[model samples]
Target: SQQGEEDPQALSIQEGENATMNCSYKTSINNLQWYRQNSGRGLVHLILIRSNEREKHSGRLRVTLDTSKKSSSLLITASRAADTASYFCATDLLQGAQKLVFGQGTRLTINP
Candidate 1:
């Protein structure tokens, strides 16, 4: 399975702090995407970095990928209370249908 697993099931941070999480996958992938879900709301795409890429950043979010190790990390810097959400890593399999398989996810809470 190309599915990925994210570490730190939950995280809490004070406003203006940083939050980091990790994800590990089992197989090769075309690309990996990070998404954020606010409670019951649908996920919102944060960023996507291809397998060939080492790192990418957007706004306050930064993502790093290591294909050799089949793992990735996400960092949210200077987080705000509005940044509190569940984060997930999704990998697009190279061989199968182009669909994203999500990780277990890391729930983040930013206290104001």
Candidate 2:
């Protein structure tokens, strides 16, 4: 599968803590995007980093990409219970245009 692999698969943390997830892809990519999905809901775009970028941030979210390692990570600081959801990393391959391959996802549970 072109889909990447996310580490930990699942994580549980208390509110106000930080949560981190890692994703490793098999091929070179044009860009990487992080998404969040609550139960029974559609995916919400969190952040995106281009191949040329090493890191990007959005509010409480921070994303870092390492093209040489074909990997990326997502960090959510001061997580809240509302942050409980599934996070997925999607990659836009350099060769495959107009297509995104998504990881299996990392399930995050933030307890109050």
**Predicted structure with the largest TM-score when compared to the true one:** 2
The best candidate by lDDT is 2
| Alpha-carbon lDDT, every model | 0.93, 0.94
Task: Encode model 2's per-residue lDDT on 1-112: one tens digit a residue.
Answer: 6468998799999999999999999988999999999999999999999999999999999999999999999999999999999999999989887989999999999999
Q: Which residue pairs in candidate 2 have backbone atoms (N, alpha carbon, C) closer than 3 angstroms, thus clashing?
A: none
lDDT (10s digit) by residue, model 1, range 1-112? 5389999999998999889999999889999999999998999999999999999999888999999999999999999989889999999988869589999899999999
In order of appearance, the predictions have TM-scores of 0.95, 0.97
In model 2, state the lDDT of residue 78: 100
Q: What is the lDDT of residue 16 in candidate 2?
A: 96
Q: Mind sharing the TM-score for model 1? A: 0.95
| Model 1: lDDT to the true structure | 0.93
